[model samples]
Target: MKDDTKIVHVGRANAKRHNVVNTPVYRASTIVFEDTQQMREAMDGAVGDRKKVMFYGRKGSPTSWTLEEAMTELEEGFDTVLAPSGLGAITTALMAFLRTGDHLLMVDSVYEPTRHFCNGMLAKFGIKTTYYDPNIGEGILKLITPTTRVVFVESPGSHSFEIQDIPAIADAVHSFSDQNIVIIADNTWGTPIFHKPLKLGADISINACTKYIVGHSDVMLGSITAAKEHFPVLYDGRQQLGVAVSPDDAYLATRGLRTLGVRLNQHQENTMKVATWFSERPEVEKVMYPALPSDPNHRLWKRDFSGATGLFGIVFKQTSREAVSAMLNSVSCFSLGYSWGGYESLICPSVVSHIRTASTWRYAEPGIRLHIGLEDPEDLIADLEIALKSFNTFL
Candidate 1:
């Protein structure tokens, strides 16, 4: 079935609920067994079995399982694991694969907290990390070593928005090493709709369901979908770490998944309008959006992704810090916030130099990231025009 159809039908229609359209949230902690033999099976390695039977609350409930199955269908993976937050899913994936004395190749333009995890926790655990440029492609082979165990990538990165060559990197890792090296991608921005990293040859794909997957900014959730061979390790690690999401949050995320395809299309349309408007403005130096033809990574995006979303960046030509602040604060419709991929629009000034280590941010102009929402494109453009006037006054 097509993706849009799958969005509404996969999770709810196939659910094993008793003649109900939606899976009922199972708030479970202690699962009762009829006999000692049943309890023994649950306590033994049989708990690892893929059967839908509940062993413990920390493992998962039916509500969370419903979401996981839906994500697995979308991601085209063997199974999926849930976490309380995006960072939690990221750390879990990293820890599950890497061990002492292992080396990791991380893309430089990854999310700030991901960089923090590599530099801090992974470093402390003796797993050395080498940050490579996001556009390296097959040249990533140069960074790999005999001990390299994993390659972590994020396409159209969190702030800088550089699209990576996932298939090239994945093939390079497999050809260069026979150690069962894993290729992991933070698929939050692309999600499964636009880009399925697993199909692009990645061993695992991850997402912060808090953003677009939740559709609203109400709940925090994360998901990690793994290929068949890699699913065992990730699943075992999640169980060992006791990482599980709230059942109520899972229900909300499931509901959000139903409308994700339509919502993302709207986000793409709104973002294209705003980003194109920024391109024509005299004050704007550049608009960094992969879907834009003039963008540096447009070709790569066109080759890999089926669509684009709301997030994109803009750099002002000759704006000062004060002017940037004034512009951001003056916007009537766009709220000043960090998180994106919600129904509401948001804008934030970016300082890429503060977070990156492998490469330098060359753009000297003041930069801003925009998350265009479900509002009318004309209204958002008018709000930006007003903000620019305020910025000019400050300058």
Candidate 2:
């Protein structure tokens, strides 16, 4: 079935729920069982192959299970586990595969918090992490050691928007036989509709459901989709950590999935309009969007992804920080904030400088990230034009 069709019907109308359209939020810490045998089965996770039956609330309920099932289907993976946040999903995947003496090869352009996790928490546990250039591709194999247990990747990274060669890296990592190298991709930006990491040879795919999947900017959710060989370890790790999504958030995320197809199409349309405007502006140095043919990673993006979303970056022409701030503050249509993939447009400064260690971020000018929302393209462009003009005043 097509993505749009699947989104609308995937987790809806259960037979036991009187044919309800959506999964009802089950808010409970404990679930009662009618028989001791059933209770034992639930406790042992033998009630269902998918573990959809509730034993304890921390394990999951109907709402979260429904969402997980849909996500697993969407990602074309063996299974999925819920996480409290995107970071939780990342940590879960890493913890599932990494050991104390293990080595992790991470993309330099990964989300800042992910870098923090590697540098701070993972380091404390004696797990060594090596951040490599996002464009390394097959060359990543040279960095792999006998101790390398995980290779973490993020395509068209969060701030720089540099598309990585996912297949090349995946193949290179999988070539190691002495140690099992798990490839984990952060698929939040691409989503399932744009890119399927499991098909690209990744062992696991992580998504920040708080963004596009929730759609409304109200719910915080995350998920980890795993391949058949790695699903057991991921599931066990999640259980060991007691990671679970709120039933209400899960329901909201499931509800948002119904319209993700339509919302993404509109988001792509709006983003292109705004990004193209920035490309032609004298104040702008470059527009960092993988979908743009002029972008350095456009070929890789075209090869790997079907489409782009609303998020991109615009580098100004040698502008002062004060000028950039003035422009951001002056924008009316785009709100100055973090987190994208909502109905409302968002703008924020790029955060690649301080967090980067493996590679240098050498932009000619200051840059700001733009998350084009559901607003009319013309109005958004007008807002940006006014903001650019305000920056000129500061200059």
Candidate 3:
């Protein structure tokens, strides 16, 4: 069956419980054992498999497994592990595969927290991380060391929006050695709805479900989807780490996923309109949305992805931080804040100079990330126009 039809039916099957379609949120840690053998089986990984139809809750309840199964099927391979946050999805996936003295290759335009995880956590564990240009492609072969175990990526990276040549890099990584090098992609921005990194030779796909997967800002959760070849490593990591999210949080995430498809389509549409408007504005320096024809990565995006989301940024040519602040603050319709992908529009200055390595993020002007939410496009455009006017006036 297709993913769209599967999304509605995959998790909700049992007509036995008041004919309820959604899985009941089973909020319990202790399970009443029927017998010693059953208890023993519960302790084992056998009960945790969704195919088994019986779970003891630490391994994940039916409620959580339903969502995990839904996500795993969406990416077209293997099983999945759930994490408390998006970073959990990334870090746990790394912990699942990498060991001491393993050399890791990461895309230069990676999320900042991921870079911190590489520098601070992995460094202390004797793992060496190497960063390569986002456009490196097959040239990445030269950087791969004998000890290279993982190639971590975040395509159309959160800050600069550089789309890495994932298939080329993955092919290059596998050609050199049969030493089980794992490829990981942070699919938070992709949300599995648009881009399936696993199709491009990625062993693991990580999504911050707090983004489009949840389709709302309320839930904070992360998930890791793995190919069958890599599922055992993730399962082993979960068993060893004893990581699990609360049932309440899992319930919210699952609920949010129901409308993800429609929500994402709207986000893509609204963002395109806003980006087009901003592109024609004199005060705007450049729009960094993949959907924009002017974006450098637009052609690559066209070749790969079928859809775009709400997350995009605009760089304004100016020296005035205060002017930027005024523009952000003066907005009446849109709220100034962080962490988007909610029902409401949000705006904030995202410019940072803390970049240490890789390409300098020096924009032609200071930049602000815009999350086009479920607002009337004209209202949002008017709000932004007035905000730009405020910057004009305040300056």
Q: What lDDT does the true structure give each of the candidates?
A: 0.90, 0.88, 0.82
Provide the TM-score for each candidate, comma-separated.
Answer: 0.97, 0.97, 0.95
Residue lDDT tens for model 1, 1-395: 99988888776754666887778888988999999998887777336645556788888877998899999999999999899998999999999999999999999999999999999999999999999989899998889899999999998797889999998998889896568899999999988999999999899999999999998999999999999999989988887788888999999999899889999999999999999999999988889999999999999899999999999988777878899999998998999999998999999998787777788888865688999999999999999999999988887
Model 2: lDDT of residue 152: 92
- Clash counts for all predictions: 0, 0, 0
Clashing pairs in 1: none
Q: CA shift at 75, candidate 1, in angstroms?
A: 0.7
TM-score of 1: 0.97
Model 2 misplaced stretches (Cα beyond 4 Å): 13-16, 46-50
Candidate 2 per-residue lDDT over residues 142-173, each given as its tens digit: 99998999999998798899999989998888
The C-alpha stretches of model 1 lying farther than 4 A from their native spots are: 13-16, 44-46
Best by lDDT: 1
Clashing residue pairs in candidate 3 (N, C-alpha, C atoms within 3 angstroms): none
Candidate 1 local lDDT, residue 275: 95
Q: Model 2 TM-score?
A: 0.97
